[model samples]
Target: MSDNASFPHGPRWFAQPGTARTWRCASAPRQVRDFHAALTGYSPTPLTELPSLATELRIGRVFVKDESCRLGLPAFKALGASWAVHRALAERAANGERRGRVTLVTATDGNHGRAVARMAHLLGQGAHVFVPRGVHRQAVAAIAAERAEVTEVPGNYDDAVRLAAEAAAGPDAVLVQDTAWPGYERIPGWIVEGYSTLCAEIDEQLAAAGVAEGPDLVSIPVGVGSLAQAVVTHYRSRPSGHAPALLSVEPDAAACVLRSLVLGRPVTVETGETTMAGLNCGTPSSIAWPYLRGGLDAAVAVRDADSARAAGDLAALGVASGPCGAASLAGLRAALSGPDAGERRTALGLGPSSVAVLLSTEGTAANPRTVTDE
Candidate 1:
């Protein structure tokens, strides 16, 4: 079967989704290479094929882009967020600014903050990460491990964003926020550019396995949609015949992408409850909207029950994923087995021979199984 046949909108659908013409990021190959070079000492994450899961699902093949093993940091967010901070420092240094005096600021529920903190420590800069009240203790611990000062504020993810923005409004503090509003574009784009590394590695791994055609679908989790945008952008830049159908997964409580897809425009929904803290972003980011609206093929919002269940499943399977980490697999598992599975698969032109990949972004955060019980 033709690769594009499974996807109703075809492989170039991302092009029409309104992303190609929007504020394009510096996502060129050279930038990707430079970003990779900046972290030359770090080890590359693995792309492990899950033959057992594929057999159970009755699919031809399935691969998990495992980012849990990245530098002991659990998530792929570190790749992008850290790269953005480093690049921002590079930008400052290029302009003759004192790099050591620069401080990076960002709002996070967890992973991104740790990434920023990690970068700050490596580059001789300071970082301050803001998190919503009731943020996960383990997440805060992770960021603190990188020597960053962490602050918690009242409200949800949105409130933390506002607090961070206020702090970043000063001189010598660069806002490295993942969610972009107006007049602040570079960091978010750089985050996406950092994400290109994941896709680029996937390309190499797939080729090594002798898989010539692209996956039938690529499923990813969305918070502010930075990683999703990056994946879609990277895939779109490739030859049309090689790109896969892109699907985004989110916590049901924070179904911003579903709302956006349904409304045909961006909309923020109140995320009242979810165990998938990392995926609990209530609103779509302004910078992420263009790419999301243009490149995303479908979205599935999984409930907290499924997220926790997927987390447990990964643990049983010895994969070690957190609630937020296993969210994409939860959504994909539902999409492949629930009421919409068959139709969705057919509509997207997937079949038994089609290969699909899902990214497991982080390991169990604070889960006793993930860390040796102290």
Candidate 2:
């Protein structure tokens, strides 16, 4: 982890200059959503506008894309995991592969494993999920409830990822990871493609609400950067002039994406302990690096206290959010109040007329007490 004493208890912002106005890849394929819509509980999540929050922040408008109840799961991971599983199976069938028993394997801090397990169960296949030490017990139990074999590793998320990759080396095992490495880009790419559903929903919902223009800013939490990459690609690929300035948020302890952007390449760092478990990743996904490099206008790293405060604030607004879910808002607050606020606000085009969308990526999956009606 970087020296926290330097960026203690606040936000550290980094601006990426010369970001491209267009995406390097094609638009998300419709078949991804087509596959998911046929499944049970396939509906768009909520795009809630919080006028009070907007007033408090002094922003033009504040929109929160809530993913708390996506696909009967507590988080948005189902969108990526389920879609990746379907694509993997479809690829097998395309090659005239024999229909044998298959098992999906991957590592997670919590939500992605549960999602993979659920998808595997739905597909009548087996799932083996690896979780790191200090993962919330509720999340592990949820994955086990799906009848997936759960293994607890002694180290952090990266260690579990290594073990899961080893387990997936078998012929009957398929790895459905959101992070990509050498020769492992295809599945992760499909996983990112799956997240397009959320972006598409946001577009339609905003249009339905009579908002002719898309948001001026989009804030997303980064783990391995897949979801952020999806958001960037979705807006940039739009035919309309709605390419919102992108903001990537990460834990101060594990700001690999920010560090990578600073170094002009991928750089791994040791992720220290963080309350936002879902965002504690030591490295950015190889597949997501290029898109993020080209699309993100700015990045910010926030402390655990920031996330906790944001969660409480959302709770006061009647939205249930875990720390990781509220991290984007935390980053937004940090960016607006930090020392570089003027430059960052100007660079991202944030102002009184600038509408911003913050993605609440999950619900209170682990700590039920974190959610409050007050």
Candidate 2 whole-model C-alpha lDDT, 0 to 1: 0.85
Candidate 1: list runs displaced more than 4 Å: 1-27, 37-40, 366-374
**Pairs with steric clashes in candidate 1:** 6-348, 6-349, 17-294, 18-294
**What is the per-residue lDDT of model 2 for residues 1-374, given as tens digits with 9 covering 90 to 100?**
21123453233677776455555556889887788888887888889999987886678889999888878788899999988998899898898777887999999998899899989998899999999987778778888988999999999888999999999998889999999999899999999999998988888998887676888889899999999889877977766566788999999988889888877898888888888999989889998998888888888898899999999999888787888989989988887874566776777877887788899999984434222210
How does candidate 1 fare on TM-score? 0.88
TM-score of each: 0.88, 0.94
Provide the lowest-lDDT 10-residue window in model 1: 6-15
- Tens digit of lDDT per residue, candidate 1, span 1-374? 11221211112111124233222333445566556755645656677787877887778888887777564467777778767876787788799875457778988988888878877787788899998865677678778778888888779999999899899887789889888877878888788778777877787788888786657778888887888888778766554454566778887777777667666788787776677888888788888887777767667777788888887876676677777778878877766675456766764557888888888888765544233310
Each candidate's clash count: 4, 0
